[model samples]
Target: MALPFARVVFLCRWGAKRWGIATAEARRGITFKLEEKTAHNSLALFRDDTGVKYGLVGLEPTKLAVNAERFLEWAVVLADTAVTSGRHYWEVTVQRSQQFRIGVADVDVSRDSCIGADDRSWVFTYAQRKWHTMSANEKAPIEGIGQPEKVGPLLEYEAHRLSLVDVSRLALVHTLQTDFRGPVVPAFALWDGELLTHLGLEVPEGL
Candidate 1:
């Protein structure tokens, strides 16, 4: 269900034009960090020179207590920063993962629910060697592009655009256009691996 490459290009161009450029402050970017306090307690957080990593090893869902703050079914976390406006870009490095989801979500997305399973979030998911763009439990297969080791998610708030970029190739993978209900934060979920996040990166040229 991937759009033709030509159409993807046209839509991206239109979005860039419609939103224009972000403020100088936004262009500089800010350091991205995951909020451990808000994350599922079963998941562990580690920091290194590259960035922060969320480790999912030894996580047992069956042992988890029934709590409103924890994501019961999936290991999920959010960034401490929220995007209200302007353009933002961040990179996620996937390692030792069988299945993972990277995306943004409303600040109020329910912790008991998995991301991309409701109206409050959107995600680019990789599972079983297949890739899909998901929202509201609906998934669209992203054809042609092979699985990427790293992904860059670019958010243009005013333009209502969320684009996934193949970091190594610097190519657009997919884009979602929708009006956001409120401020959103970078969201992540994993079934069997860790994710390293890089922030403060300037939006790549022509993407």
Candidate 2:
């Protein structure tokens, strides 16, 4: 028989707490890599010769010529792997990129839209010197954290939590809580410059 609404809520809360406690002490490793086939502008996605980094080097001349009047210019890329269970963590280095969004997206997220434009995605965005946490077309300014050169995103899938961390200061910048519908992949949107993904890492302690 179907349970009552109150019991359902109680079970969810208990499950979340149990999952959090289970992952608190262990160091979980996640594999990460951008998938070229999943990019909105695959032509603009490039990997270094060493195969250790990824970048969006702007649009090609042919593409620009065809859509010169209105080209969004933002390229969104998803990782080759998806996280369906457990807690996964990874970091992204934003050194030369001035405008970008980094976070996680559901497998079926719309390719035409940038990250955080829909309910399927969550991103910590940096644009025009401002930092904001965004999802479902809503954005909230992240004040006083200063500009972080590197951002660490910790995904607790079972608990439905995505936490953004400032790697330099070891500070927890923000956390997004929601019921993730299905498998989620690492997602990135870039207007210009490069983004380096750091994988196979352990979640840092002390939040």
Highest-scoring model, lDDT: 1
Q: Over the stretch 51-78, how does candidate 2's per-residue lDDT look in tens digits?
A: 1222334334345333211213336677
Stretches of candidate 1 off by over 4 Å are 1-24, 48-68
- TM-score (C-alpha) between model 1 and the true structure: 0.78
lDDT of 1 at 116: 91
Q: Candidate 1 — number of clashing residue pairs?
A: 0
TM-score of each: 0.78, 0.73
TM-score winner:
1
Tens-place lDDT digits, model 1, residues 44-112: 667733333445343454454443444544577777667778888888888877688888888667765
* Model 2 misplaced regions, further than 4 Å: 1-28, 42-74
